[model samples]
Target: MNRKTLVLPAVVGLLAPVLAACGGSDSGSGGDDGAIVVGTTDRFTATKDAPAPFDPAYSYDVGTWNVLRQTVQTLMIQPKGDGDPVPEAAQSCGFTDSGNERYACKLRDGLKFSNGDPVTAEDVKFSIDRARSIKADSGVFALLSTIDTVETQGDNEVIFHLKTADATFPFKLSTPVAGIVNPADYDKGKLREGFAIDGSGPYTLKTETDGDAVTKAVFTKNPEYKGVLDVKNEKVDMVSFEDADAMGAALDKGDIDVMTRTMTPEQIKKLSDAAGGNKESLVELAGLEIRYLAFNTSAPTVKTKAVRQAMAQVINRSELVSAVYGTQAEPLYSLVPASVTGHSNSFFNTYGDPDPAKAKALLKEADVSTPVKLTLNYTTDHYGAATKQEFEQLQKQLNASGLFDVTIKGTPWETFVPAERKGQYEVYGMGWFPDFPDADNFLAPFLDKDNFLKSPYKNGDIIDDLIPQSRRVADRLTAAKSLTKIQDIVAQDVPVIPLWQGKQYVASSDDITGTAYVLNSSASLQLWELSRGVSG
Candidate 1:
């Protein structure tokens, strides 16, 4: 989880009935056969500043590139509810017998891209190789670090030769970062030049207005998109809003069918009330995305393990959750949220309640006579309604402890990412929406040295012993034991403090049907599974 908190000041008055204004009815939805309208907060704007190319190989924010990847294909996909690999573009994949080092994948017959190009083993090889070589923003490439070389065994089969023996190699392939693209799209050994849409997934980009910059992606049924996506809606019209309020208003006014991200608790409550009586008019799906705070351990003051532990004990997570989110969020004690495999309450076990006495004791043990002053930073609009309040509560709790002085800073995501990456603040708040549904996704990103946070922690036990030992074991139950140990160490060390795990609130119009509310590890909505209900 990234250490950023978003606290939305409650809108004081009750919302009046928003006037419904009918805009241009797109050819898809009800008027046209097999089309659905979806609403989302914030459109990606490159008008003022050109966006980096949308290549899965380097794209770090998985949420932004979700639609594009739906049009593309990956080697494997996580079977719903388990970390086990299920074939998507690949027909079958498994590890070699030599201590889980070598891995091989076989593609299904007659698979082709939207452009009608055959999906050969070379294309799969090119996709994975480019992801590693390009080194784009994606954390997914971190998984490819274990791979030493790629060898193509004919058009249908490919083999991955590994530098490390890891049984979790197949799970990495299940991420969108491993989504397959056309080999011909890129120039010879170049990263930034390729930006064409040529994927073999369930959808194809039908109409995109680059100048106006509103992306209206249309997904037609790919006869070859015979994977696990039980698509109920044939076409999806994704319209973007400037912020969550706009998206919420659109849903209330019946202009859009679905709303995602940036949804506030107030909006969720209203929608929930609306859905209660009218079953056909609305639907809700609660999901698991964890939010937390990260301490830059490399910083001078935070360098002491005692100080880190003290901070964790001082901040009251229960109070933060109640004040910021009300009943919207559940207090999280582990890095792995409750929905994912291998979740354990190690932090809760260690620190039962916020005790100022315990914090002062730890601070004194570190030999800190003067009051420790630290700056806590969080992104303004990223996490949701509860972020700002959560930080404020944290600040109050820490200040009340009398052992520490705290300063809080807030910035927008555009400025926050670079700032946090450069270690601008002593401590910052952030959340992790998983890239895939696995305990490893939670553990790997924050703990891994090269990740976005770039934590300077050098625990040989976690890096060398625990993480590697866990990856070697294929059985999830056995691997979970090692992960539990890692969390226990994290609770003690406090490099990153565990806050609250998120419960997703999605409200859909009564007119929608067949919406399987499966929260993918990324916390992104799977729009293809939704359809128009019998009545709008």
Candidate 2:
């Protein structure tokens, strides 16, 4: 998802240097997971699990964005592990006004959709303008809040007028939300007829096979494409599974060349334990994703800061990581990932260790009765299957403190998301998948009134003061000091408790080289970098 700064090496095979970086051979060659047939249940190329809308403007989740990256061309793009927004579809682009509110770009000549429609400035204008207008569930509008108008001048030039002066505007253009779409093929307020896309990307849909509500889409080199990525293979086959089991079975049978995300902790353990299996078929990418418990401040028991702080104080992250997640994830002490700028151990800094006796004293100080009764809510579908055991472990830990009697409840993600948004659960599990690699994304989304968290957290210093101040600075490194303070404040306030950061893994059959090198930081596979190993 050159769409955001992320990694699993969760696209591990994509970062070939990681092995050398991790003390492997210099060429960073994966032995041979490089089979021609690739299989993944990862949502990065989907219309269902993630932001399922296949149209460029409607796709927001990383899975959908990754698929679009192969199918559509944007003005700019972010490469693996790098957040810088660089030229793609545009010959060149730059801000034209002193306010940093006006941007302009020149289209690369001879670009066309797979359908053969000429790509032009009007298509770029329409694509962006429609994304702002449609406002789909994928949450594309959050990234483009500064845009006010898009002006097209002839066939090659396009200019954007923005409502605010944002230096990150160029990075926004690199996303698929701004991928140019042909006006003749798409209508306003409606998605394209089917998920099969028509674009000027390196690959075009060649054939699609559907059965039992799951579809496998095959992409062949787009004859009309004139872009950067060199295609290593003539075709790529991607399939979406009913669930993890279906995908795991395919991998065991060598039905696919590679498998992406959604491997269960148990499944990951099995693969890693196999002899020479990890070295040949897998690469583990330590990730930036955080899994935590959000304490609904409106809930009667946790309404006060003292109660929330007690909950945070009593829980041990190390225990959760080991007992439940195994090697798949590590203990997290900060809201921001260490890979990103402004990552501080604010939570760790605030609370030194899991102090149950101290927790009971704090609850007493807050006038909370002994044996506090509380319910912990979670979703079985969104989080991995290991989540149930994790939450159960959490219940044991909280109960062992002698200050809490914790109850666990489970719901599916589709129902859980809306319910959590409505503040239906007193405390619920939430995972942070950054919209972009910026520390701003990790903080800003939690601060806004209409935030992704959907909570009633209104910290004026964070939401109104620090975040705005942080965004005004163009350089992320310079903004770190300000953003780090934001995390410190959130940690002290305790609207949510930071638990653990995930370690992402990409399992590929050993025949593949470059699987680790091909994924962008977002763990979205650059499927083109993969090639089958030549047999002796």
Q: How many clashes does each candidate structure show, in the order listed?
A: 20, 26
Candidate 2 ranges beyond 4 A from true positions: 1-35, 42-52, 81-83, 97-99, 190-196, 206-213, 276-280, 299-301
Best-performing candidate as measured by TM-score: 1
Candidate 2 vs. true structure, TM-score: 0.85
What tens digits encode model 1's per-residue C-alpha lDDT throughout 449-474?
A: 55657677767888778888888887
Top lDDT prediction, candidate number:
2
lDDT of 2 by residue, 1-536 (tens): 00011134332113334331121222122214322566555432232333335787666556566678888888987665555767788888998877777899998888888898899898898888887787765455667766888999999999999776777778778778888788877776766644667788888864354531236667777889886667787677777665678877777666765667667887777776666323235666646677888878888888988888888888998998899887678788777877677789998899889999888888888888878899999987655677788899899999999888999999976567668766789999877765556777777766655466667878888866787777767877898888889989988889888888786666665555556555555555677777655321
Whole-model lDDT for model 2 versus the true structure? 0.72
RMSD of 2: 5.5
